[model samples]
Target: MTPRTFSVVIADDHPVIQLAVKSTLSAAPDLHVCATCSSGKELSAALATHRPDLIVTDFTMGRSEGNDDGLRLMQRLRQSSPATPVVVFTMLTNGGLLTRIRETGVAAIVGKNEDPAVLRQICLDALAGHRQRLSPAIAGLMASAGARADGVASPLSPREIEVVRMFAAGSTVTAIAAYLHRSLATVATQKRSAMRKLNITSNADLVAYARDHGLA
Candidate 1:
């Protein structure tokens, strides 16, 4: 019998990164690059059509048709393709962004600045249904995040913090609800509560807070 092959869909806005990732993955004997998409819209379409075993995508792909982008895109994949593992390949190093990404239950996260080999190995591991893996840097961040959680008595719940982080990263309320599986009212309530806790009266204030906290 022929060996089974794993298919991957790579999504990113940068053509150069897309090409590099494709070339790297194609070098693996059992891995195949089924499609490459430049936007979240294209990623969604590719998911529907190709149904690849795994997805390698940037954390932020500019908005495209279907309103899929960044956190929203990750949420859609979680809801629509629960079984397919997703690998976030991006340059974003924001702690808040990392927190929000973890909430979406991604399979692996490899920084774009790291060697391409790192991403390739993560891909191979994800294909095997192994537990989620975080690169050393990401693991360290999570460790510090935990310490922060323990030492700081933040007025906001982790969920609320995550929601604010996504909003700061450019997600709309509706998109947040869709991604987090919260009702519109629930999302709004959390947003309002987060703002109130931080004494933020406007979007500008919320954004500024996020930036100050390295969430943006």
Candidate 2:
């Protein structure tokens, strides 16, 4: 069987990093960058209009005003399309952040400080169905002092689980509200409650918890 041609959407707040990703991915004949977004809101809007095979996103965007903007976008994406792979490339390499991102079920994690070629290759491998963890150093730290040792699965409610799954699939809050037929504020409240229950202080942390507990 022929492999499917993958369409990707790149989401990063940094112009330089966005350009770097675009330039690198452009070299691959079978991969196409269908959209580039600098904020979670922009990525959410693009995903509503286009269904890409994968999403390559930054963990944080200096340009975003909303809370945990990048992770929110990933959650929204996952909510809308669970099968679509999302790869996080960012500078937040601390064990705490890495643990949270893992929970979000991102296909791969690549540090910004790593070689651009290496990052690009990781993305490519993820598109081909491989689960690439963070760099050896990052992984070593996580294996040592991170949530893996905590052994506490997140204490998320079924509703929150539902919210997270939807978030991960790429459903916007508005979409989520509409789908659940609840008010926006109510949906937001429930999501927040879930985050609090899990002791997740940020979207990155939420992602890590979800990845760790297999909730995402």
Candidate 3:
């Protein structure tokens, strides 16, 4: 009898990274790359069409227009295909960001810097319904989520930081509000408050702050 094959749907906005993941996963005989997408939107459609056994996606997939597009995508997937396990494959190293992702109940959280083989193994583990695993980097971040220095304390709340990260990742305020399920006025207020707390007077400064803090 032929061995069973596990289908996977991989989503990332960058063409290069998408191709690289497809190539890496294709090397595994039992792991089939059934669908590849360039954005969270595309991934959602693919989920409806393919119903793959696993989902491997970037935290920043798709257009930056929807700042929380990636997070919202996860929500939709949880609602639509709760049985399929998800692996967050991202380069994000922010502890706060990882904490938020952890709340989504993903099966695995792997950093892009790790070997593709690590991801492959994690996928296998996830398919078997094993306990969730995190990369050492991610584990470290999770262990230190709210332990910042008093002198260097960040003024932005977790939600405000999320808004900044989304904005830095290219999401517009309108998109952010919709994704977060909050009113436009609320989103705008949070954005303005974040700016005020950070003393950022311009978009450029905000972007710089995000970059400096490894948010974007």
Which is superior by lDDT, 1 or 2?
Answer: 1
lDDT (Cα, tens digit) per residue for candidate 3, span 109-215: 88998888888888899999998778776776656656232212245765787678888878788987777778989888998999998788898899888887668
Residues 1-216 of candidate 2 have per-residue lDDT tens digits of 976678989988788888899988878877888999988777877777888888888876632234235445556667877888888886653454456667767888777777677777777888788864565545665666544635332355445665765665556777777766679998888878988876777877766666564344
Clash number for candidate 3: 1
> Could you give the candidate ranking by lDDT, starting with the highest?
1, 3, 2
After superposition on all C-alphas, the RMSD of every candidate to the true structure, in Å, is: 4.2, 8.1, 4.1
Per-residue error for 72 in candidate 1, Å, reads 2.4
Per-model clash counts, in order, read 0, 27, 1
The models' CA-based lDDT, in order, is 0.82, 0.70, 0.79
TM per model?
0.75, 0.63, 0.82
Give the poorly placed runs of model 1, Cα more than 4 Å off. 147-192, 199-209, 212-214
The segments of candidate 2 whose C-alpha lies over 4 angstroms from its true place after superposition are: 1-4, 62-70, 147-216
